[model samples]
Target: MAAQFDKIAIWLVAFIPMPVAQGLGDCFHGDDRDFSSAPDEQRFRVRSDIVVSGFLAGDPQETDFHQCGETVKLDCATGEVLARETAGTDGMSFHHFNVGNTFPDPEGGVVDNPNEFCVNFLYDGAATNPLGPPGSPDVDMNVFFTIDPIGRMLSFRGATNAFPDYEAYASVEDGPPVVLFQQKHTLDPINGLPGGADQGVSATVAI
Candidate 1:
């Protein structure tokens, strides 16, 4: 697979109140499981976001690569984003495939709340998609996230592909996404698409 253009920015967002950032939505309102006597719906503000992307050449695919698009998270209080990437990680390769890295993706989440929200993102090893099991197709380290933050965040429980919690900007009255209910099954813990760009690795007009 060859490389695409410099940067391909894509936003898959569905706001309840409406747009964010440039006059972003004030908050999101909705019902809850306890409709019998539920209180008034709380407003959720855009608390944070995770922007996963790759530059033209020299894409980031290593541990603590700031521009790898997995280093920062939005910080609503101080009006800034928090650092999500941790330096000095013990990342290792499994059969040429790297693993053990954390990447936060809030905007990728569809299930939001005024109090609680699940963080969605990938662990990183998937990005260094090395050759798989002898006969597997050729893999690229900097090309495993063509649909990242769009894939699915791995959780212990949950069913259906929910949005990335890292992508959601909706939060409640200066509070985090509220907890509508607690889901115990099929939680989204896995987050990663099949491909991306960047890293120390580069091909001669190839991925």
Candidate 2:
């Protein structure tokens, strides 16, 4: 069955508590700050560290998958590619991508205040028992990060599976977390659709 984006958003909002939801908002827009005003030279001096982590969730067989793409960091304002890391092997279910220090400015300076960035997690693999034939679809997971005025970190991950499942999470941290999980699914790229039964459960809880 095909998965609907609207339905997934509504379900995630319902699953998350009001406080957590508000916290996510704060991360994205709470603080009034921008990187445009900083001088070209000074901007390069400001830096924010980033770390990406995630693991497979649910039944081992159902969640069995691998990443065929890379994790990338993009400048929110210009949509420029800042850095990227390659995907891990199939045997390594838990994945982590760390860009220790990122300079958000064009001059390669650090961004000391509130700023926004995006991380993409892409995967192409098969499940042990997918709703359809294995290796047919690709999964694209995204995480958006906002650094508050004081450098507090807030992030959110939301992805729709080629299978009948979705995963999402919101988190706040003083520094980058040691690990994060990549949402999983089975898809058929040729047909451009998911190929599995609807597993009616919110995998966000695992986050």
Residues 1-207 of candidate 1 have per-residue lDDT tens digits of 222322222111111121212112111121112211112223211111223223224242322221112223334445354334321212312112121233222234233311111122332221111211232111112111222121212121111122112111222223333222221112111222122312122111111
Q: Residue 46's C-alpha lDDT in candidate 1?
A: 12
Q: Supply every candidate's count of residue pairs whose N, Cα or C atoms clash at under 3 angstroms.
A: 55, 23
Q: Write the per-residue lDDT of candidate 2 for residues 1-207, one digit (tens) a residue.
A: 111111010001101111110111121111112222221111110111222322112111111223222334444455555555443333223222222234253234653432222122222222221121345333222233322212323333333434322332233222212223322324323322344323222222211
TM-scores, all models, native as reference:
0.19, 0.25
Candidate closest to the true structure, highest lDDT: 2
Score candidate 2 by TM-score against the native.
0.25
